[model samples]
Target: MNTPAALTLEAPAEHPFAPFVRILGKGKRGARNLTREEAREAMGMLLEDKVEDTQLGAFLMLLRHKEESAEEMAGFTEAVRERLTAPAIQVDIDWPTYAGKKRHLPWYLLAAKCLAQNGVRIFMHGGGAHTAGRLYSEQLLDALAIPLCRNWQSVNEALDTGNLAFMPLQDWAPHLQRMIDLRNTLGLRSPIHSLARILNPLGARCGLQSIFHPGYQSVHREASSLLGDNSIVIKGDGGEVEINPDTLSHLYGTTAGVGWDEEWPALSARRHVKPASLQPEHLLALWRGEVEDSYPQLALLSTMALALRGLGTPREQAFEQAQRFWDNRDTSI
Candidate 1:
């Protein structure tokens, strides 16, 4: 009569992605890697909102704590691409910009416009301002009168009319955009940032990307290879697809689904300098020839050269052609 009921605790039900979290979060000796299929399934569950909040947070943190494998990154990206829809227009290049510029104006925007002017159909997609103080491509596109496309239909229409269109990440995939927005709460970037860059929803023949950290270079290279897409991943200034005219750049890429790499020498030997401020007018003026700034010119030409290279132009010839296109650009605005 004096004996109390035996104390007992039951384990919680297993979430679908719980195993994935455990595989990454297990103490070093017990942890293991998830196969590509496993990663694809886990990511599918995440995108479908099948995983619980606790499991989702644990999964994302586990991925952040451990460097993501190429298989993992590629699998997650494959899931995203499968879930998204884009018009079947013939896109020459896939340009994904997630990293906003803090120290420099996004010269890459003008570079994409220049390529579009030369008959290169480009589809640009990106998320905006999570970290503050950085200049996002979306914000700057408005000043240039480039409308943000709402869907594949609008994207197709814009490309048909102008050969270039910018789509926001929120419009393309809201779930992933929600994850990206968590950068503020998580206090660090999760693997979603990397996966978003390689989606290439239109199945474009070529893709261009940039990373802020040097270590992630190989991650992007191998992931792009696994996705079987032609891509160029560079350590661009402020982590954009644009380069700094004063610094040599390492270009990691793939061709016809094969990995290749090269170094883009600096266009100028002078010390690196930052503009006093980012005025959208400066970008417009530069493109219209109202201003003559050597650094910005080199940035645009070199950035476009990389895109042209992805399109199969020889290195030297690509740079030369980019310069020619810039000089011949329509300036009636």
Candidate 2:
């Protein structure tokens, strides 16, 4: 009796995404950064949800550990941009606000409002509050009466009517928004945080990014250059695009495929103290001229100057024009 023939079983096949994980996570001597093409493919898989949960977590954390390079960021941005379906809307500036403010109110919102009131079309996007203890821009939109656009159609309408619109990442890129929401589970920020800032989905003429980390300003600048995007990267107040009034800020940027750097001097000689709590209502009050705070005033004007410079205004003229826009703003909103 040939006893039951010796049993044979087939081994499981390797996953398609395993190669990307190995490319990033292979041991110290073997691991290396992904090429731009490889990064584009990897990010495409992520956006398509073609990878497993375990693989997703590992890939994200490994990228976080290595800190994304400009090539990787550019490729990832390309993947995301490829998936965007919004038609071009003739926006003058592309503003990304991911880092919620902890040290001060979001003065940049008022600056954008001032510009919009003066005929500059601005497209702003953000991820809603995923991290606790910070005030997010979306939370204050109601106070400012800025329409929170829920779809591309609404965004187009808002831009046409008011020259400004704010959209949350969830509305446009739900997969990426889900990845950002994993901050609690992952216990660290992922490359998605940086990648989202450079998307510039509508192909706006100017992309403005604010990063808190020291070296990331260069990464953003170079990546924007690679993408042929005219962009400015700043280490702004609380990591939002709003310039701080009390300290000097460095602006790293790329224009027409060339990189440049600028130093913006402090607006005030004395450092302002952080507020105990951020009041959303104060934004409306300040816009309406009911509040008189020097800190927010300078913060708003200086932030607008950065954007104005991005729009081709000369440096001195940018500051003067920003102040004029603020003074001439229609405050009855």
Model 1 scores a TM of 0.95
Q: Rate the local accuracy (lDDT) of all candidates.
A: 0.86, 0.91
Give the clashing residue pairs of candidate 2, or none.
Answer: none
Cα lDDT tens digits, model 2, 146-236, are: 8899999999999999999999999999999999999999999888888888999988889999988999999899999998999999998
Clashes in model 1: which pairs? Answer: none
In the range 205-298, model 1's lDDT, one tens digit per residue, is 8988887787898788898888788899988888888878899888898987688889878888786577788877898889878889888888
Weakest ten-residue segment in model 2 by summed lDDT: 1-10
Positional deviation of residue 190's Cα in model 1 after best superposition, in angstroms: 1.2
lDDT (Cα) of model 2: 0.91
Off by over 4 Å in 2: none
